[model samples]
Target chain A: MKLKSTAALIGSIIGASLLAATPAHAQNVKIGLLSGITGPIAAMAPPMIAASQLAVAHVNEQGGIGKGGKLEVVVGDSACNPQNATDAATKAVNIDRAVGIVGPACSGAVLAAANSVAVPAGALLITASGTSPQITSINDKDLVFRTVPSDDYQGRALARTLKGRDITKVAVAFLNNDYGKGLAEAFKAEFESLGGTIAGYSGHEGSKASYRSDLAELAKGGADTLVIFDYGDGTGLTILRQALENNFFKTFIGADGMKSDAVIRELGADNLGTFFTSSPVGEASSSLESFNKAFTAAGQSPDAIFTTTSYDAAFLMALAIEKAGGDNAKLAESLRAVSSAPGEPIMAGEWAKAKKLIAEGKDIDYKGAAGDHEFDKNGDVPGTYAFFKVSGGTYESLGEMK
Target chain B: MELIGLANYAIFMGILIGIYALLALGLNIQWGLTGLFNAGIAGFFAVGAYASAIITSPHVAGRVGGFELPIVVGWMGAIVFAGLIAWPIGKVCLRFRSDYLAIATIGVAEIIRLVIKSEDWLTGSSRGITGIPRPFGELDYVASQLAYLGLVIAAVAVVYFLLERQLKSPWGRMMRAIRDNEAAAAAMGKQIEARRLQAFIFGAAVMGLAGALFVHFNRSITPEAIDPMIATFLIWIMLILGGSGNNRGAILGAIVIWLLWSVSEMITDRLPTDVALQAKYIRIFVVGLALQLVLRFRPEGILPEEQARQTAR
Candidate 1:
C-alpha cells in the first residue's frame, strides 16, 4: 500500500516534467545557455549568463531568428560538475530542443556534456570558459567549440612577450591544479624553446600559510623574476607577499589567473610596481568596446572574467542558427561559416546586419568581443593577448603580445 | 518529435538512475547489512573510474596506460582495483565506531580526490581522461542511448538479484546479527573484524563497478565527477531514504531522488526567466528538505527492514 502511493507520486512528477517539456511557442528558435550557476564557480556564472542573455536580447530586438521567429534561451545550471553537466545538457538537447548550447563553463563539465549529450545528439556546443588543452583532442566531429583560448595559447604568448622584453632567466611557482599546471607546462616549453632559462620551477598546493621555505628553495637558483601561475585571490597572493617581503625576486610575472582585483586590494597598487600579467583581449578593440558599452548599459560589469567570451559564444550561436535556417544538422558547418573569414565582417551586437547578410546568402565573419573567432581545425581559438601592469590602483595595458 | 524527445530524455534519466541504484545498493551492503559507516564512496568510485579508463583507453604519451584492453576486462579491472584499494582502508579504519569511521572515510576520500587532481600521469590530473569507448556509442543518438540504458538495467538486475540471494542466506543472517549487536555476535564465535572487512571490500567493489559504468556511459572521467557531494553523499541519501537494509528500497530511493533532482529543474524552467535562474538554486534546497522530512517522519525509511522472524513466517 505504501509503495503504491510512492509510485503514484513519482509518476505524477515525471508526468509534470513531460508536460513542461513542450515548447510554448513552436516557431521560436531555442538555444541552451548552460553555465555553472550553483557550484564551484557560482559567482562567475551570473555575469556569463547575463552576457549570453544580452546576445539573445540583441537577436530578439533586431528581427529575432528566421521568418519572424523569436530567439529563445533555456538556461540550465551545470553546477560545475559532470553529474549536473550531463544531466543539464540532456534536458537542454532533448527537452528544450536547443539548436546550439553556449556553455557548461568549467573544463571538466564541458567534456562530459559534449561527449555524453551534445556530440551524440549532434547539437552544437560553444563553451565560453573551458580552457583545457585536453579539449583540443576530443574526437568531436566538429561539434565542440569554445570561445576562450586554451591555456596553451596564453602561456605561449606570455612566454614570447617576456622573451621580447629581454627577460632571459626566471623562476616559476605554480598551484598544483589543471589551470596552473597547464600554463606552467606550456610556458616552460615555449620559454625554453625561445632559448630562455628557467632557473627554478616548482608546483605547490594551494592555501598553505607560508611558502618561505619554497621561496628560499626557488631563490637558490639565483633568478630575479618569478612567474606565478595561480589565482591572485588564492595562494598566489601568499607567494607574492612572501617573495616581496624577503626580496627573493626583483620582478614578478603572472598569467591571466593572477590578474585579479583582490591582489591589488590586498597588496596595494604601490607595492606592485614591478608586477606584470598577460591576459586575453579583443583583437579588434572596437568589438570589445561595443560589447563593454552594451553590457554596461544592461547593468553588468563587462570586465568580469569570461563575460566577453560568453557574449561572443552566444552571439556566434545566434549567427550560426540564422545561417543554418533552424536545421540542427547544419549548425556545425554554419557555425564555422559564420565565424570564419572570407566575408563581410560582423561586429558584436550587430545581429540585424548579420541576419540580413545571411538572408542575402552572403558569407559573414564575426569579429568577437574576446577575439576574432577563426576556429582552427580542432574548433580551438588562438586568442589575442595583451600585457598589463598595475598603475593608479588598476591594471593598464602595456600593448598587445606578439 | 515531442514524444521522441521525451523518450530520449526518459532513457537518459533511466541510465543515470541505474548507475545511482548500483551505488545505493553498494552502500546498503556496508551501512545496512554490515553496520559500517564508510563515508568515502567517492574514493572507491574514483579508483574504479580511473582504473577502467586507463585499462580501455588508447595509450597517451604521458599517462601510465596504453593497455587498450576489451571493455569487459576494463570492468573486471575496475572491480578488482576497487576491492584491492578498499582492503587496506577497511583493515585500518573499520575498527572505529560508526561516527569515527565516517570521519576517517571522509578524510580518505578527500586524499583520494586530491591525488587524482594532482597526479598528471596516472589519471590525467584535472584535465581528466577522455576517449573512453561506449558499447553502442556509434549508433544514432536515440539508439545509442537506448542501448546504454539497456546495458545499465541489465547490470542493475544482476547486482540486485545477487544481493537479494546473498541477503537471504545464512551469511546474511550472521551479518544482520553482527550489525544489530556486535558484542553478542562476537560472543557467538563469529570473527567480527574479518566479516566487516569482507563486507567493506564487497561494498567498495560494487561502488567501483558503478563508477566503471558511469565513465563508459559518459565516455570520460574527471576528478569533478568524483566530488563527494554528488558521488558520495547522494548515494547515502538514496540508501537511507530507500531503507538501508532493503535492496529493493535502495533502488526505489535512487529513482525517487534522481527524478526529484532532475525534474524539478524542468518544472522551474517554466517560470519567468529571472525567477527560473534563481529557482535552479532551489532544487538543492528541495533535495535537502526531502531528506529532512524523511529523517523526521520516516527515520526507518520508506521501506523499513522486514524482521527476519516475520519474513520466515
Candidate 2:
C-alpha cells in the first residue's frame, strides 16, 4: 500500500513536469539512440553519440527523414550494463515513441535490448560499434542491422593473413569481456580449422594495470607469433611489448580491439611488425582530410579510429532511408540494395548520382568512410579487411587480412 | 530560465533523500541497533528488486507469480524474501568478528550478482526484464515519477518515525545495550542473538521494500542493476555523512546528494553544446572532487546523530 501510494505521488509530480513539453515533442519524428554513455565502453561510445546526433542534424538541415519536417533524437544511456540497456531500449521505443534505434555499442548491450524491444517493435537497430558474430547469427529478423562486421569476419581475415605468412602456431590471450571473448573464439576456430595450432590460450582481466604474470605464462608456451585478442591499452599492451624487450616473443597478432594508433604508440617501432585486423577504413581523400580537420577544429580527437566509421554509418543509414522513399521499413528492405561491386558506384562522392538513380528506380549501392559495405546475408558486411603494420609513428596498410 | 522554478529540484531531492532514508534506516538497524555490519547491503537490495521483478514481470515465463499484482503486495513479497534470506546469512556471519562478517557478506553480494547475471531462467540472463507495468502508468511517465516521489517520501518518513518510536521504548534500550557490549547485555538476561536477528531481519525487509519501489519506478529490472558501487557506496556514504543511528540525518544526506547530482546534470545540460560534449569527462572529475571535499569538510556529515542520554533519577 505504501509503495503504491508513493508511485502514485511520483506519477503526479512527473506528469506536471512533462505537461509543458508534450505539445512541442508531438511535432518531431523521434529516433531512439541507445548508447553506453558511461562505464566500460564509454571510451568508444560518447563520440559515436555525438556523431550520430550530428547526422540527424545534417539530415534535418537537408530535409527530414519522412513526412516529419524535423528529426529529434532521444538518447538512452545504457551505461554498458545489460539490465540498463533493456530498460533504456523499452523507454526509448515505447515511452519516447522513437521510430528506430542507432546504438547499443557493446555487443552484450545490443543482445540484452534487441530481442524483446527493438525486434518485436519492428524498429530497426543500427549499431555503430558492436562486432560480436552472435548478434547477426542470433536470427533472421532483418530488423537487427549493424554498421560493423562480425568478429568472425575480422578473425577469419586475420587467420588468412597468418596463412599468407606461413605461421603455424600462436599463443593467444584475450580480455574476458564479450568483445574480447568473441574475437578470441572466432580467431581460434578459424585459425585451427585451417590446420593451425594454438600454442596457448588464456583470459586476462582488463581493469588491472599489470599483465606481466599473464604474459609470462603465455611466454612460457614459446610460440613466436603471439596473438593478443584483448583491447591492448597502455596497461596490457605495454606489458606485451615489454615481453619482447625481455625476449619473450618477436611478432604479435592483435584483433580489432588492439587495432588502433594508441596500440602502435604504446608498442613503438621495435614491435613494428605487429599485425591487427579491423574493418577497412577506406582511402582518405582531401575531402575526408578536411572533415578530419573540421572535427579537430570542433575540439574532438579527430584521429580516434571510430569517428569516421560512425560518421559514415549515419550517412549510409540516411541514404538508405532516402532511397526507400524515406521510410524505415523501405529502408530496411533497401539495405540489401546497397551493393559494393559490379553495380552503380554509390561511394560518398557519388551521393548526388545515387540520389538521381534512386529517383530513376535504379539499385543504389552505398560506399561510405567504412569502405564499400556490401552487406551479405544476415547484415554482416562482406567488406575486405585491411591489415595495419605499425611503422614509424603511423599505420601502413601491410595488405588485406584476407 | 530562472522562472523554470525549483519544484522539480525540490521534488527530486525530496524523493532521493527518502530513498537514502530507507537504506540508512535499514543499515542503522544492522549497525546501530544490532551491532552487525553488513557491507553488502546493495546485494540484498538487488535481490529484492529481482525477486519482485520475477514475480510481477508480465514477460518472465508469462509472470507465473506475476498477475501484475498491486505494488503493495509485490513489495510485501520482496520484503519477506529479503528477511528470510537475511536470517540464514546473519546466522552464519553474526557470531564472527565484525571484519569477518563484512568480508563474508561482501562475498554473498558477489555470489548473488553472478547468479543474477548467469541464471537465464530466473533473471533473464543479461537480457534483463522490461515493460514493467508501473503502478499508475495510466497517468504516464512524468506523473508516475511525481507519484513515486511522493509515495517514497511518505513511506520513508513514516518508517523513520515508527523506528524512532520503537527505539525509544524498552526494545530501543535493549538494542543500545547490545550495541555497546553484547556479553554484558547477554549476562543481563537478554536474548542477544534473538534481538540482533529481529533488528537484522527488519532492516533487510525495509531494503526489500525499497528495492520493489525502485524497480517499479524505473519500470524495469535487470541483473546488472545490482551494481554495488552505487547501492553499497551510496548507502555507506549516506549513513556516515548523515550520522549513523540518526534517521533524520540519513534523510537529509540522501536529499542533499540527490540534489547535488540533479543540479549538476541540469547545469551541464545548459552549457554550450560543444563544451558540454567535452564536459562529460570533466563531470566525473567534478563528482570525484565533490565527494572528496564533502568527506574532508564534514567528516561527521551534515546532520550528526543525536546520542541517547538517560535522565538522572
Candidate 3:
C-alpha cells in the first residue's frame, strides 16, 4: 500500500510538471519580458514593464501581429543576477517558448542569459537598459542586442562635458559593479586623453555603513572636482552627504545613474547648486511626443529614463514579428531588417502603417520613441548625452553633448 | 528541440545542485560534526572563485591575471588559498564558543566582498574577471552543459567520499566528542583547538573547491554572483533539512532545496507580469514556511543522522 502511494505521488508530480511545461498559447505570438524585477534596480522595472505592456496593447489594438494573432508577453524576473537570469531566460525559451527576450537589464545578467539561453535557443535578445562596455565583447553570434548605447559612449561624453567646463583635474569614485567600473574607466581614459589629470580614482563597494575613509583618501588627492558614478539609491546619496559634510570637492559631477529626483530632494536645490549630471538624451521626434502624451494620458508618468526605450524595444520586437509573418526563427533577421536604414521610415505609434508597409514587402527603418536607432554590427546605437543641473528642486537640461 | 531545452535546464540545475551540495557537505563538517557555526560561506566561495579566475584567465592590460595556469593547478590553488584564509579566523575564534566563530566569519565574508569589489587590479572591479577556463566550454550547449554537470558531480562525489570516510574515522569521533563536551574532551588530553581548527579549515577548503567548480562552470565570477546572507542562510537550511551530521543527507538536501527554488521560479514565471513581480517574494516566503514546517515536524531532518551502531555488518 505504501509503495503504491509513493508511486502515485511521483506520477502525479510528473504529470503536473509536464502539464505546466506545455504552453497553452494556441494563437498568440509570445515575447519574453525579462528585467530586474526585485533587485537593486527594482524601482526602474515597474515603469519599463508598464511601458512594454502599453506597446503590446497598442500592437494588439492595431489588429494584432500577422493575421489577427494577439501578442502575449511572458514576464520573467532577472533580479539582475547571472544564474537567476539564465534560469528565467531558459524558462521563457523552453516552456513559454518566447520568440524574443526583451531584457535582463543588468550587464552581467545580459551576458550570462545571452550566452547560455537566448543564443542557444536561437532567440533574439534586446536589453532595454544595460550599459556596460564588457557587454560589447560577448561572443553571442549577433543574437544579443541592446537599445541603449554602452558606457563607452557615456564615459566619453562625460569626460568631454568635464573638459568643456575647463575642469582639468578630478577625483573619481565609483560603485564596484559592471556599470560603475566600466563607466569610471571609460571616463578616466577619455578625461586623461583630453589633457585632464586624474588626481585619484577608486572603486567603492556599495551598501556600506560608511565610506568616510575612502572619501577622505579621494579628498586628500585635492582634486577640484569629484566624479561619482553610481546608482541614485541610498549609497550614492550617503557618499554625497559624507563628502558634503567633509567639504571635500568644490564641484560634484555624476552620470545617468546619479540623475535622480531623490538626490535633488534629499540634497536640496540650494546645496545642489554646484552639482551636475548627465543622462542619455532622447531626441525630439514625433514618435517620442506621441509616446509621452499617450503614456501620460494612461495615468503613468513618462519621466522615468528608460520608459521610452522599453516601449521602443517592445514596439520594435512586435514590428519584427509582424515583418517575419509571425515566424519566431526569422525574428532575428527581421529585427535588423526593420531597425536599419534603406527602408521606409516607420515612426513610433505608427504600428498600423508599419503593418501595412511590412505586408507590402518594403523595408522599414524604425525611428524609436527614444530616438534614431541605427544599430552597428555590435548591436549598439550611437546616442547623445544631455547635461542636467538642479534648478528649483528639479533638473533643467543645460544642452546636449556633441 | 523542446526536450533538448529541458535537458539543458536539468543539466544546468544539476550542476548548481552539485556545487551547493559541496557547500552543504563543508558546513556539515563545521556545524554538524565539529559544532562550529559559519555564517560566511559566500566569502570563502568568493575567495576560491577569484583565486581560480585570476590563475586561469589570460592576462589583460590593467588587471592582475595573465599567467593562464593549467585549470587543474588553479583549482588546487583555489582549495589551498581558501583553506589558508580560513586558518587564522579558525585559530582566533576556536578558543571561544561557536557564536564568536559565526560573528567573525560574517565579518570576514564582508571584508572579502569589499576586497573583491574595491581591489580593481586583483578583481576587475565591477566588470569582474571573465573568460575563466572551463574544461568543456567549447562544446555545443547541451554537450558542454552535460560535461560541466559531470565534472561538478564528480567533485561532489569526491568530497562526499572523503567526508564520509572522515566521519567514520577516529578523528571524526573525537571531533564530535569535543563538540558535544568541550570540557570532557579537553580533560581527555585531546588538543580541542587544533582539531576544531583543522575541521574548520578542511571544511572551508571543500567550499573553496566548490567555488572553483562554480566559476569554471559559469565562465566568470562577479561580486553579485551570490547574496551572502540569503545564500548562507539557504545552505544552513539545506544542511539542517538534510540532516547535518550525515553526508548523504547534505547532498540530498542540496538537490531538494535547489529543485524547490527553481520549480517555484517556473511557477511564478507563468503568472501575469504584475503578479509575477510580486510572486518572487512570495516564493521566498514559501521557502521560509517550508523550513518552519520541517523544523516543527521533523527537526532531525528528512534524512536523520544514523547513530553509530556496535553490530557488525
Off by over 4 Å in 2: A1-38, A46-78, A82-99, A111-124, A132-144, A156-165, A274-303, A320-345, A349-363, A371-384, B1-37, B42-177, B180-184, B191-227, B237-267, B281-313
> After superposition on all CA atoms, how large is the RMSD of candidate 1?
4.2
Docking class of 3: acceptable
Per-residue C-alpha lDDT of model 3 across residues A44-123, encoded as one tens digit per residue: 88889888889998998887887777999888878887767877887787677688999988887887787666875678
Colliding pairs, model 1:
none
| Candidates 1 and 2 compared by DockQ, better number | 1
Best to worst by lDDT, what's the order?
Answer: 1, 3, 2
Candidate 2, residue B10: lDDT = 48
Point out the worst 10-residue segment of candidate 3 chain A by lDDT: A18-27
Interface RMSD of each: 3.7, 8.6, 3.8
Q: What is the TM-score of each candidate against the true structure?
A: 0.94, 0.69, 0.91
Model 2 C-alpha lDDT per residue in residues A32-130, reported as the tens digit of each score = 776777666677776677666656666676545444446666666666755456555765665556667777777666765665456645666777776
Worst ten in a row by lDDT for model 3 chain B? B304-313
Across B1-313, the per-residue lDDT of candidate 1 in tens digits comes to 5556788999999999999999999999999899899899999999999999999999888899988899999999999999999999999999898999999999999999999988889998888898899899999899999999999999999999999899999889999999999999999999999999999999999999999999999898888898888999989988888888999889999999999999999999999999999999888888888889999999978888777437657
Compared with the true structure, model 3 gives a TM-score of 0.91
Which one wins on TM-score?
1
**What is the iRMSD of the candidate numbered 2?**
8.6
lDDT of each: 0.92, 0.67, 0.83
- Candidate achieving higher DockQ, 1 or 3: 1
Q: lDDT of model 2 at residue B198? A: 87
